[model samples]
Target: MFKIEVAKMSILFSPITIGGVSLKNRIVMSPMGMNACKAEDGKVTNWHKIHYPSRAVGQVGLIMVEATAVSLDGRTDPDDLGIWEDGQISGLKELVDMVHEQGAKIGIQLCHGGRKSKIPGKIMAPSAIPYDENSIVPEAMTEEEMYEVIAAFKESARRAKQAGFDVLELHAAHGYLINQFLSPLSNKRGDKYGGNLENRYQFLKEVIHEIHKVWDGALFVRISATDYHPEGCSIDDYIVYGSMMKEQGVHFIDCSSGWIVPPNFSERPGPGYQVPFASQMKKEVQIPTGAVGLITSGLQAEKILVEGHADLIFIGQELLRDPYWPKRAAKELNVSIDAPPSYEYIWNK
Candidate 1:
């Protein structure tokens, strides 16, 4: 703990309310898979106990738990967390309680890896396409299979609520099952779940509908704003999806781009590379959005909010590097923030 000269008021340190849930600040810990379950059973483990609460203590306003499987076969990795069963609730509740005790809100990213699943079984996708040359060619999902997946998501949302999460995020990005359905590059079936953009959106629409039955809390949907290929989803397409999500009562859209299939970009990611997506969605859809991807530094995060480019700054790797990133941001912005009572002596000095 240390003291710094105060400057002007910082919007980065300002409180915000989304979907009736008030957060202490706008900084969100973007979900990043830890693969730490160790048992491959998807139960919360000792690693989760230590990893999540540390950030809460460090003062992150909202911590989104990593992509957690809705079903065993939906797991991105064998050891990824799960909310598919009642047995998982107790462990998850314990983790949520720890974070709440430290005065931070916690959310969980509900996901279905689809073709990307590492579990030892045949994976299912909207179409029978493989993610890439080396990836497995997934079985095309039938109507019954699609219903099963939606039910899985519904059940997962129930479990997440029972486990005491403050928010629920649908993992619709990064070429996962929902992304596969949303992007034309991967979905090619000639049914109601395919063809036009609205058709492709049918699956996610139903999932959201079912989840809303059990969850009336702040709901967020993470999306790959662009497929990065001309044949794939474009920004205009996501604008429509964003509008749909807004109408469906989604509180926020976590804007991230690419990985709908594979990387096709010529340039590497730069700072705030994905901020424009959030800006576009926010303006066009009239919905609050979170900008993710490579946004580091308090000034940079503040700039995004200041310009009305995004409502929330979703920090990923930066938070991993420094759990006390909120403190660093406060210091950089020259704004004073409260430290835990245990560290107040040194912080006040």
Candidate 2:
């Protein structure tokens, strides 16, 4: 029955199971930080309550929450969401409940901004390198500081679980903390946390290990597959990292690129510029992967999944432009999507 149903459906509307949780479709609302969380102390607000549920009603299979800092000092900006404290759990749980009420599986992205943090505090990084000449010089993390960040990830995962999230993703991408460690350009340390790729990856690997101790849901890691500069992390580097993550039981690699340092390379942005990264990771690592970056239409998403380039399609800015993009996508793909009971008057028309 399942095989026959899938055969008759557009691949984008097909169901997929990831680490014991099954999604209703392949469309994922990629995590985009909305600086609307009003309280600067890292709490969900009325804006989030309205924002997330609207997308769930549009029928996205999964909705990954914005980059939520694991510590107050780790915020990319003062407005980013946070799960660092037990006090924040109530508001987060409410956010999760609201999304679940609309029948969408929601996940939260746990992160630490590291050198990318704009807060007025001591910033942490694998080494004391600044992102750019104008950026603040970050303090090189002591061995003790490294362990503190790892513990923070673990504790945040615990909070996410308690808040009833269906999935947990570690934000190891962009020019953020974990990405700072992953790229040699940002990390010029001589310790065990620097030098070789193995050392660079150790921070994230240990973070995953700690998160695993507290949470057992679908796990994902968003990575900057390429730093777009020489001697920086490349797709080839991610292939190796993807396999290691697969071995660590990560369900998927959310393949995004650049922003580690000033990008040296430029590609004309079009549909699926980063799909190759996802395809390469899936092909080489034999792990499920998500393709993000400028994926805006149903046919484009369908093509990526059909060609086996990626298991999930992450729609970011497009969704911000239109919260009902999934509904429009279903119409474009000629796939039927049901509206909630309150909006069932479309059938009467």
> Which candidate has the top score in TM-score?
1
lDDT tens readout by residue for model 2, 101-147: 99899999998999999988798888888989999999999999999
TM-score, each model? Answer: 0.97, 0.96
Model 1, position 315, has a per-residue lDDT of 92
Q: Measured by TM-score, how close is model 2 to the native structure?
A: 0.96
Off by over 4 Å in 1: 1-7
lDDT of 1 by residue, 1-349 (tens): 2223334877778899998889999989999999988555899999999999999988899999999999988999988998889999999999999999999999999999998887788899999999999988999999999999999999999999999999999999999999999999899989999999999999999999999999989999999999989799988999999999999999999999889777967888888889999999999999999999988898888888888999999999998999999988987887888797798788667
The candidate that achieves the highest lDDT relative to the unseen native structure: 1
lDDT minimum window of 10 residues, candidate 2: 1-10
